[model samples]
Target chain A: MAGDAGSIPELDQKKYDADEQVKIICLGDSAVGKSKLMERFLMDEYRPQQLSTYALTLYKHTATVGNKTVAVDFWDTAGQERFQSMHPSYYHKAHACIMVFDVQRKITYKNLANWYKELREYRPEVPCCVVANKIDADLKVTQRSFNFGKKQGLPFYFVSAADGTNVVKMFREMIKRAVDYKQNPGDFMDEVMQELENFDLEKKEDNSEADEDGLKAESPDLV
Target chain B: MSFEAKRCGVQFSPPSIVLIYEHKETKTIRKRIIPVRNFSKYSDYSMAAERLKNHPRHRDYLEGVSQSQLEKLHIILRDHMQGFSLERSLASFNLDPDEDLNKLDDEELARKKGQMDELFEKNRRHKDDPDFVYDLEMDFSKTTQEKCSWDEESDDGF
Candidate 1:
């Protein structure tokens, strides 16, 4: 091994140059404190402002994880319908997803299934973590709210964006999980579950029927 | 000897179940044979049964299902549950049909184009410049000014 002492420096340089880039997407309904959680985790400061992200906002941060430097890109997405059309592209190539829901709002908790459905449709292999944000407002969320995650076999975290409680812990664990997933690709059971949920054995008759109905109804020249 | 062994040489060969239902839109009846193993990775027999009951095509068929037919379905599904391995099942599924239909209309396209142009204009000033210190400070000042103006405009909109 000492025969290649001169190559040690080159190896160190190559390792430094090959830092892993992990893309993590934050998804949830509007006003669920997704942006606040991201800002609190990245900047260690949270300010209440009229923050309405119209499109995908990218936040870049570098961290050292177990002797390896990782570049983490957090994509904060707008939950409004105006930006919904661009979601597929935003979710494309994402390594991990963080689905946030407000603990105080039952509607946000119920909507997690829809968000998860869309996430699986786009990136089935990627791991997802559900975040129950604004826990400071309500320390107790219904156990039923978490049954969805349990059924789907997803990791869940409860945090408060306002007071910065468990925000750092959740993000660090997510980063480590993402890095481990990237280094050691393993079998994903959740992908199988998602596939089964989306399976439809019906024939493709809806498309042809819709096409014929549209053509007959819209063509004035035929009349 | 087991029933399967007495009938055939196989140890546990369960009969495959076939379901016939009429398509609501096309008014055509179709028959589908259920897979003996791996009914679904996520759903159990009860969930699949619920889905079948709620399915528009199978609604009529399920409405008139006799007690014997229901018992037969349950028995087949219970047998199928034995082969439901998460690791062995195929994980591929079709993407949402509506996802492709999310095309932006002309008005939305024009707005997006305007936003892109604004972004390009904001970035065009600092392109092709190697002066690190000067570019960094200038970009910082320009970004602050742009944020101030954006905040004012957004306040007005609100």
Candidate 2:
């Protein structure tokens, strides 16, 4: 759309049904290749350019999940200590989460624990995937990152977003799993809504009783 | 939740309005300590005023400071921070200056905008060059206003 030579492929609108769109968020430390992962998956190519995200980055990509095509809202969050305070909002109300760590950087892998912890505490039900990014680096570096992911029992994948490795495949699988899970979000949402409705009804009933008591006191023995 | 878990400690609360008065002649800055009775009512920015109002400590904090005292505090803090002028700072980051809405009404906004635009333009021309380190510092400061928007109040609200 910006008149680039090798433009990114747009989604085929005909493939989608009229159902709701599934939203997935991508979050991790800065320079963990979060934007590169997003570019490779959504744009199908990566530029050699560098752009530092301040607080948040948003991208919308459409991918087919089963028979219906879903539009996923991917949120890229800043990973500095100052930005750590902003992470909860991105984690809040997320449907699916991806915690990315750079294979070459050990500290990035360590920071994933905080990302995982915050996601669990804020939105426990959201499914997550841990990514070992920049795998094009040395094998020894990637191996360490993989071992860390295995220890956490998180479904891990090694991706080189620059060269367009398993990034697209991983995202496709994420959408499929999300669509499958949404087939029945179950009574968790329904039960919460019902409880809220019941509380409102109870409040209304109590207000009416108070009104009746006030009327009776004002016109005592009139009947 | 246990009492300790929900305990609203003084340190766990939001940051207070930090005022630093600068003397041009001496070039020294003095920090002023403003008492905040209701830590919840501390407004970091205008965008999240509603969220701050809804905070549990907001009411209690308001009770601590009278209306006139709060206004005085606002003026003191604002003046101390050079008006906390987002317009003056954010102008450097605007790529297309003419397209900008110029929402800030500061008297120095236009002059600051011109100076920042020139500096940003000069820096942008070299930011991508591998040998350009000094220009990157200018770029770094330009984006720092966005970092302010990520403070405690804006994050929890927006």
* Candidate closest to the true structure, highest TM-score: 1
lDDT of 1 by residue, A58-101 (tens): 67777678999898777776434233323344554566889887
lDDT of 2 by residue, A87-119 (tens): 333543356778887665555565666565555
Give each model a TM-score: 0.44, 0.42
Show model 2 residue runs off by greater than 4 Å: A1-19, A44-54, A78-81, A142-145, A149-152, A186-223, B1-158
Q: Chain A TM-score per model, please list them.
A: 0.70, 0.65
> lDDT, candidate 2, residue B68?
27
Off by over 4 Å in 1: A1-19, A44-54, A79-86, A142-145, A189-223, B1-158
- CAPRI-wise, candidate 1 is incorrect
Q: List each candidate's DockQ score.
A: 0.01, 0.01
TM-score of 1: 0.44
